[model samples]
Target: MSLTRRKFLSWLGAATVSTTLGQAAQAASNKHFSGYPQSHGVLFDNTRCIGCRKCEEGCNQVNELPGPDRPFNDLAVLDKPRRTTAKAYTVVNRYENDGMLQGPVFRKIQCNHCLEPACASACFVRAFTKTATGAVIYDPSVCVGCRYCMIACPFEIPAYEYDQALVPRIMKCTLCYPRIVKGLLPGCVEACPTEALTFGRRRDLLRTARERISQFPERYIDHIYGENEMGGTSWLYLSGVPYREVGMREDLGITPAPQLTAGALSAVPMVVGLWPVLLTGVYAITQRKEKIVKAEQEQAVAAAREQARAEAQAQLAQALAKAAQEKEAAIAREVKKALEEAAKVPTEQAAAAPPADTAQTPTEEES
Candidate 1:
């Protein structure tokens, strides 16, 4: 069934958060949200997992996912570490034994269905949701491909359908939301040969886990994972080794993720809504400033060129004037020397012709 765009976005935003955005915001500003009163859950015993891939087969068939490259019976695939993907909602991984001795420890990996899922906390579109049944349901029709759920999930449960170009969806275990509603167990849990995975109400499951741990203290760790982690998760795990050794995240604390992110997610609309306008204004201002600076730089350059041209002209004129004056002085000195030479020639001529023309002499005239 197709969801209307408006409803889709609304649920997308709603499902994205573990609680209402308004409430998260309000609580973050002044309070917090404790988890739901009652929800179903699953308790996984790591020591009981045999890594047979029966759960994987059940999940594949129930979900109707595409077949894997290798068949379900192939234990060779367990040689390497694996994670849940779009094709497979759940995966059972084999880890080297920490002296457990039965064989390599196997851990069934799937969505933890956190009470306050970080994925919900990050999403504003309501693509993910924590149901009353303790299942974390996803509405792909409402999802806008933000993949924020994938990022916010502390367990790293959510995966995207990169291969489906037209209609990719966020893929993860839904705790078999459809079947559980029909009073049927999740396919993987039901197919478990060793009953490693037990399904029940979260409260009851916690008690059962405690009893088991108390009874077989040597086979299990004292701590029950997901009991208080990230404000608790529907899926719990009891491991022979430390949670980390079995590929479980141990760093998450007891606080709900939504409480931590409410303050941030609350500002999402404010940021996404206002960023474009603010960024446009900033860009416009920056462009205006750059234009003004460029204009001023060009004007300064023009002024500098004009000043340099004027100075060069002045220097050229001064040099020409100095050269003209020197040329005039040299010409005058040469004319004076030529006149002296001409006077000497006349005197010599007159001295030789003095006997021939005595009457014309200057001494006769003076007498």
Candidate 2:
């Protein structure tokens, strides 16, 4: 369409306002994230976990993480809720159901390897990656240590090595990427004595979860925790009671976090996008007002100059007229004096002629 300046400004304002509003709204929508088609996963059967802490030992051995302050066999540490840390990639927590289920629940916590991970989305330097094997990995070499990923994580994963001052790095579960590539199961999965943790492809694990729920309906809550939570994760959970009772976040909707965050960043572009029209209108108005004031000033100056020139010309004309009248009066006084002197000379000559005539008669007798 042919857009005038006013028309363009109007359209820009509407577009900017709409874009800002739309992006803010989209950040909270519910949607799922589907990762690679061939991604591998694990399903943790919380109903079967014996809270043995064997998974912790296996993770410690395989990842060679720093030694914990306490021993891994210490079951007394499960008295309180503990999360994954820089030195520990996984932790098993115990939950007392108060006779709601068959027994107390044990939950192994780690990075979920979400299909669309919030940490990956939050990192500007691309330090985090969601691998095709359903592993979310971080590269410390490229990490700027801004710690934005730490705040973005919904599962509260991605612990940072605060003591490693010279070269701090984020620590989290990699889903056993190296061993999985070598065709070996994760240490935690292999060390489970009760088969509480099941290792398989995500699709197979999800199907297996459904089968277990269908066969033993009374044994499970029928709601697979990670199957659709945050758009699916490599780590799944099946619980006897509600997932919340076992330290799982039930309020986290099925929406992938990245999609919801896209709108919050939209405000940045709105600042950039709307400035063009707003500044242009302001500048145009200021310039027009300046031009009008300048023209008025110039007109006033020209009128004053014209008035001064006319007054000077009138004064010159009056001075010339007065000088000509004074010259005419001086010439008339000289002419009257000359005429009176000529009349006096004629009368004096006629009186002198009578004496000459008497003297001439005597001379004529002698002739």
- State each model's CA lDDT, in order: 0.84, 0.86
Q: What CA root-mean-square deviation does each model show from the true structure?
A: 11.3, 11.3
- List, residue by residue over 18-42, the lDDT tens digit for candidate 1: 4434553554354544456678999
User: Once model 1 is optimally superposed onto the true structure by TM-score, how far is the C-alpha of residue 245 displaced, in angstroms?
Assistant: 0.8
Q: What range of 10 consecutive residues in model 2 has the weakest lDDT sum?
A: 22-31
lDDT of 2 by residue, 113-197 (tens): 9988889878888898989999899999999999999999989988998998689999999998999989899989988999999
- CA lDDT, candidate 2, residue 151: 95
Off by over 4 Å in 2: 1-33, 266-281, 307-367
Query: Candidate 1: RMSD over Cα atoms?
Result: 11.3
